[model samples]
Target chain A: MMSFSLIVGFFLLWEILCIALNVSDLILPRPSEIIVTLVTRFPVLWPHILQTLYSTLTGFVLGVIIGVSIGVLIGTSRVAYGVAYPLLVGFSSIPKVAVVPIFVLWFGSGTTPAILTAMVICVFPIVVNIATGLATTEPDLEDVLKTLGASKREILWNVGLPRTMPYFFASLKVAITLSFVGAVLSETVASNRGIGNVMMTASSNFQVSLVFAGLIVLALMGVALYAFFSFLESRVTGWATRGNDIAIT
Target chain B: MSMTSDISAPARPTAALQPATQPASRSNPVHPRPAIELQDASVVFGSGDKVVTALSPTTLRMARGDFLALVGPSGCGKSTILRLASNLIQPSSGIVLLGGREPAAKELRIGMAFQNPTMLPWLTIEKNVMLPLKIVEPFKRTFQQDKKGAYRDRVHALLAQVGLQDFAGHFPWQLSGGMLQRANLCRALIHDPDLLLLDEPFGALDQFTREELWQILQDLYLDRKPTVLLVTHDLREAGFLARRICVMSARPGRIISDKAVTMPQPRDIGVIYTPAFVEMTQGLRELIAQIRK
Candidate 1:
């Protein structure tokens, strides 16, 4: 599942080539040696992994709350939406990675800068999704409510917000994954700890095997976080699917 | 918007519009009424090149327990008239009154069935049917107190009447078009509105289902007798269900013919194949053709 055996197979092929060429172990340290190094260093790497996971999770949660709230506000009011939507679009188009140094300079390294970086890049999807869902409420249904003399507040609470949930949750899942990527990128530049810092140190010291392990952890973290959010998404949207009624005639 | 006029019936309460907007209220009919009235009202939407007159001014009165249908082609404004009567849009250049004098009463306990069925896709069928009562005050206040019993019983009863009893727990998508439309009908009528406006309620169903619903609708009308205004392009449906069908012309829609169907009560589907039924459908069809021209 980790694809380690495939790397082992490639190393075996490389080892055979090295033997034929009479290459030295010092020049191309045997794959077995790298494995020994990987095992020993993994213990050292554990704290770094924890640091990255903490920053990523915090960033994701903070970004999602702010994004979804703003999204709902923009989505509901036509006048506010018209005035502010273009600015949101412009902001979303900017490559957030380019602004990482600015955030680090302002927040001064560690989890704070990393979080600001992740949130900057990850909040747009929630806004766009919620706004679209709320904007397209069925006119017929609205008319029915109006004729019945329902207050605007009642219509919004009973209909508008309920209709927007599926889109909101979907964007949340995507945003969580993006937030993690943003955290890693931010850590690569400014963090003292975290997986990104270890990878940076390993590359500088030519510890390619340890660097490989760190990457594996990065991928695993992303997948695990994505899985976690997917489960949350399904649970949150269970009501939405049931409301759509796919069972009876 | 022009869309308003494009879909509503053009025949308005012209007689009322000609008189003062503050014209003396006509004496209430001696009979108890369903609570909807339009006095010489005309609705003109948009301006210049986009100008559309959905309904011409004409006095129209629908009493309680009356079952009426407006038969017209596309752009004839049948649905517009229903919207105006339901107070969805204000009538331009005329007065459209509801439930007599009280501004609050003027809103009328009105229900409407649209082609989309328009059920909130996220709510279950029972919840959708109970939707109107949740938001529309008096009912909203009453709904809070009767939380446990009122909605469930009423939703079940209405869906059962339309043969969706088992689907009370289902979502809108789980149901077929006919079933969804049936649910939508129940949703509109759930408030037990005194007046019901149906815009092509069965227009999207299969012929068999359409005919089947004719009886279901007839039964519903028989039971509740809400002052009903059905807007449709179907001549046979109008002939079968309505006590009176107002045939409307295209573009600037106006009532061209007011045909009364005196067919005996409880019009069973078998009566549809009768000679009298055939003649009536033909007559209505011809009236539409004349208007189309």
Candidate 2:
């Protein structure tokens, strides 16, 4: 439904601009011409889209796993939080997008650079969100466990992990979208193939609809990842869930 | 009830007598005797110019099924005593043998309910109560047997005892202070521990609710008869619930005075208005006052 609306919206704008000023085909291709190009170019673009999906998903999973572990570590331990938290905040503030070229230089073109870029870009929020969740554990629960002859493992497993889950799930959702963005950007700068590379090629050839198609694929991919995490949230939290409104953070 | 320590409990009196003196008798004719065998138990926080003795080298034996209350002023190490029992921190010197073992993970069948009644916000009241049974043993055997069925049955029974059978599905945040404290008792009792330690549990409750819980607790003790160490500032509660009230001094806390209050079973709230309850409350309050000085 969304893709149909987006297509219609793009066509209306494309047709209006093309007809009003009688614009040159090279400068702004007519909507019909763009559609024709999209059909003819689908076979070429499909593989690049797959490549980007692989890199983005790979990077996202890696980033979230590492981020959550670090977050839990820092959040639960005073020494770790003092050492790691400020550095994370500072590192997140730096323009991570600027490192796309550096990643390419180190890893050499194609998938590696794109995956590394996505992973780096995706980690900060997951760490911050998970850390906040772990730090915010109810003081009462901690005391109860301590007094009940519970070990550190028992407290972490029964109370700590379940308590911080909403945060972890929330951070994963954000990381999914950001990872795709990172993958596309890295593909644009360095990759031989990917949705980003396809979009760049489409724009150079004056295929506006094909560019829009690639953008549509990127949007759909992000949404699909979000939906996957949503399913996961329901599974993990069903035991202790209050209601349907599962606020991640 | 295996009598291991030979600390025999004086038999139930056929006719209630007016607070009989517990004849300084430590020796009881039983196999498994439980006496709080503390040789030189002490705790010193910091040192030198800032040296603080939270509890001095003192000795006292609280019998197995005794309702002992530690009453003192703020910062008087009343709470420190409860912590020492739970093995939250080891004493600087000496030991505390809970049923012949130094408070290991599973040796001492101990349960703690804090003042806040800190129920895990995530679990429902039923699930929270069932939690202790899942962790501690034999119940773990029951946990493995038809896990959900066993837990549900146990939870329901516990919730009923706390007058929270209808609210089993509710979260901790949804419950009021009175309900939470009731749930706290259910959680502590869920494991059926030999010892139940209370650290100013009702201190935060309003007077009415606190008194109501005291009555609820009196019945529980009469039924379960668990060895209870209750620390409280409210002399009325201490006087009403505890069989023996240990009045402690400020800082370097020690059992300065141990007074006994013998009241009948299932104590009614009407008893609080009676002259006997008032007199005992006043007497304990004076003892605390003298220690505070």
Clashes in model 2: which pairs?
A: B3-B32, B4-B31, B4-B32, B4-B33, B5-B32, B5-B33, B6-B30, B6-B32, B6-B33, B7-B33
**lDDT values for all models:** 0.76, 0.78
Q: What is the lDDT of residue A68 in candidate 2?
A: 81
- Candidate 1, lDDT over the whole model: 0.76
**Which candidate number has the best DockQ?**
1
TM-score of 2: 0.83
List DockQ, one per candidate, in order: 0.57, 0.44
lDDT of 2 by residue, B36-59 (tens): 455578988888899788998767
lDDT of 2 at B56: 85
lDDT of 2 by residue, A92-209 (tens): 8878778988887888888998898889988999998888887899867877777676678888888888888888887888888889999999998787799999888878877677
Tell me the deviation in Å of residue B44 in model 1. 3.2
| Candidate 1 stretches greater than 4 Å from native | A1-39, A238-249, B1-34, B101-106, B142-148
